[model samples]
Target: MRRNDCFFVSTNIFSTGFCSLRKIVRWMLVASMLTSMPVLAGKTLDGIKARGVISCGVSTGLAGFSAMDSKGEWHGLDVDICKALAAATLGDARKVKWVPLGSQQRFPALQSGEIDVLSHNTTWTLSRDASFGIHFTSIVYHDGQGFMVAKKTGISAVHQLSHADICVQSGTTSEKTLNDYFRAQKMKFRPVVFENFEASLKAFFSGRCQAYTTDASSLAAILQRETRNPGDYLVLAEVISKEPMSPAVRRGDDEWFAIVKWVVNALIVAEEEQLTQANLDTQKEHGNAVVQGLLGNADDIGKLLGLDRAWAYRAIQAVGNYGDIFERNLGSGSPLKLSRGANRLWTHGGLIYAPPIR
Candidate 1:
């Protein structure tokens, strides 16, 4: 048997030989350290705290989803998500730097650490989820592909457009979905593809294409913002493909993932509890126990994610609940005038549902 300063000799009952317990302990320690490397090297929350602001990647300008106003202020459904995340992470919804991203720039910016979160209206597909080293938190919007045509075209249904030219963005799920749909229906059409939505809008308006196809929500935004007479254009009744739009974060950051996900759930839950920002103060005093727990009154739910107890409360106050956000940005009051069809709460016979705060 040999003994050294770093090694210890021990009897091994299983081997009838000398064994080094110190060596075994050293190996276990190394294994433990190796397992924790990801956490130590890349703490997304710590970096966000250090920066004092969350860099949120958003679309260039999509009218109702994430667009810049005349005064260069970002406002929309997606922008509210960023504000909600900032409120949850930093206890201030305004602690966010909006990074305008084109479709080509979004994933690269996220992967390169240029943005803390991609709150853009990006779809959650299996290929994107599996191939890209990114994680989708939760679906914030339930959307589907649809077509918009001039009222004078007299085209009432999707099947009526045979041999027609359609304007579409070049690199998007909408383009692929359009092809799949037209092919499935055995319809022939020319795709007037453009590199960006602006160009597609211009082409569609210039009469270069008979129809403009994209997510139905986007079609409404385009018509409301760019059209001379929105009444002249009609969004069709058919919704072609499922587009489960969600927020995404860099992979391997479970703490950040949970925080983003729960913030969205908190919004939905707040709506369910009728916890508006105006009544938040009053509700905290004498609200129901479930609402109190959800608002972080009776529980330390925020501390579980390295945040203050009022994190969810701050988020709801900043952007209102999911329903309020939808209505203000994309619903009746907004230019889009989108109805809360699938985006309504579960209690209202829609798909929007959140897990319990407990």
Candidate 2:
């Protein structure tokens, strides 16, 4: 028999025959590896950490959700979600490179791995989930498609605006919602299409369109900032779509997706459990066991999400829980003053639920 590095020689009774122990050993090793190999694909987290910044995708400019401030500093509900991920992954909430993306481009950017997580105001629909190879995290905010019209139009309800000229963004859920509503209601209107919200606002403001339609949150932002008189426009009292705004990541990246998903969930969980920035430091010393586990006090739970144990603690310290972000950025404290109707906790008959950290 020939012996070399590529082949092994066995001297046992099986080795003497055609059935060699070396071949059996080879089969065993191959079988073992085949069964034990990792099923979930990609090294997404390590790639982001090595780059030293969490590349987050956000809306081009939606106020409350994501928008640039006067100094070009980004702040909003969606931005806070991304910052939470940075804290969970890198221990620094500010360790993020914000990538402003439009509606149509967000999915492609995520699928191509151009961004780690998308904090854009995206809806979690079944088709998007199944087709985009992306997964939705916690429902960060509950939203609905609606219309905002000038008060002078004398249109109190959404249906009352007959032959209304509407400003709408192209290639968005807003477009679909607008079409469906008009079709169902047997109504006719001129849809002034624009590629972005800024242009839509311009058209609507100039009377090229009598009304501007978008997500209710976006309408609030556009009203306060873009229009001549914020008070002159009113959001019609009809929600046309069920929008569960969430963060999404590429498919087959379970570990990485889990990290991103839970970072946002941890905020909601933290808030529901009454963990806050002011008392988080003291609570770590001695708190409820559930709160301790969630806040990463009793365990290195943060490390499990590609962050230090105190990563979640730092996030809570920086921005706060889901409610806190909403309250400060878009709630009564801010100019938006959006009500927490569908965004409240399930106990309060809303959909803001989070998984247990344990």
RMSD vs true structure, all candidates: 10.6, 10.8
* lDDT of prediction 2: 0.82
TM-score of decoy 1:
0.87
Candidate 2, residue 40: Cα displacement in angstroms equals: 8.1
Reference-based lDDT, residue 92, model 1 = 88
The sequence of per-residue lDDT tens digits that candidate 2 reaches over residues 128-247 is 999987898768889999889888888889878779888899878888888888999999998888995667777888778888888888888777877667788888888889888888
Residue 28, model 2: lDDT of 99
Q: What does candidate 1's lDDT look like per residue over 16-100, in tens digits? A: 4324666788899998775544344348889889889999999998877899988989999899999998988897888999999
Clashing pairs in 1: none
